[model samples]
Target: MNDTAYTELVMVREFKVSPEKLFDAWIDPVMMRKWLMSMEATNKSASSDPRVGGLWEIIDVRGGKEYRAVGRYLEIDRPIKLVFTFQMPQFSEFEDTITVNIKATEEGCKMVFTQHIRVPVEENWTDEDTRRAVEEFHDSSQHGWHYMFVGLKMLAEEGITPVMPPASE
Candidate 1:
């Protein structure tokens, strides 16, 4: 068995908002919940402190089961960049880092998310295996992030929140 495993996935999205406002939403839990929650019907599953060495925790419930990701903030540069660790409590074996970069464009904001996953060598690391894993993560994350941004745009334009279906429903 191999001793280590690694994978990287990157996703990008453009939003019709200024970089500063978009950046603030990323760091502020209150604002983050408006878009980050898995279910639009509920509030954020947990809280996060957007500072170096701070903790980020979220408890998401689906089908009456709870899922969590707990980690520490490694870097936080407002309106520009953020890097943090990610861990799953259930498996306890998956630990990773996620970095978000925000750049301002003439028309709006360009946000890029990069997720790095490191796994045990026992886990399959074939080319196909790696490609599938990264593709899955990239697809799911892109969808979620796009949804979040859409919700954010609606909030910004109308001062109203968008509703999403519950995972249970």
Candidate 2:
């Protein structure tokens, strides 16, 4: 981990909803199922343990294959802040830490989300190659996060009710 080059990705968004409502969208499994996965994902499901050190996971199907977002909670400060470890095992072996800070505003709330990514460069790669790789990785990740945030915003502002899947026998 010491040798890894960490990249920080930060995003901020304001919502027209109470801090508690916005924060609840992150920890509650049903809300997570609706907003945590990529926009193209389907059959999304989530399970959570929101206390510090508790593990949470969300799985979504895309093209008939599953992609997961798994994490362990590191900090939980109610409607104010949350810190967790985020991992996508199907994509990479490295883990990242995500911090989400929320503050109440006159109209609603503002959220600052940050992800610290552990980007490992191969020794044999040229500097230009390393730069390109990291940029591409971050770009894709940022795009995905933007999509998820759109869903969050919709959930907050429009109260879009998620159509939950039927119970499996």
Estimate the TM-score of every prediction: 0.76, 0.90
Q: Evaluate all candidate structures by whole-model CA lDDT and list the values in order.
A: 0.71, 0.83
Model 1 whole-model lDDT (C-alpha atoms): 0.71
Model 1, runs deviating above 4 Å: 119-160, 165-169
Model 2 C-alpha lDDT per residue in residues 1-169, reported as the tens digit of each score: 2245667899999999999999999899878877787432373679899999999999888778888989999999999999999999988789999999999999999999999888877877777877887787788778878877887887778977434321222
Model 2 superposed RMSD (Cα): 5.5
Among these predicted structures, which one has the highest TM-score? 2
The local distance difference test score of model 2 is 0.83
lDDT of 1 by residue, 1-169 (tens): 5555566767787777788887777667766666664534555366887779999776766667777768889988888998988887696566788898989888788989888866545455777776665666556655665666577766654555677632321
For every model shown, the clashing-pair count is 0, 0
Error of 2 at 142 (Å): 1.0
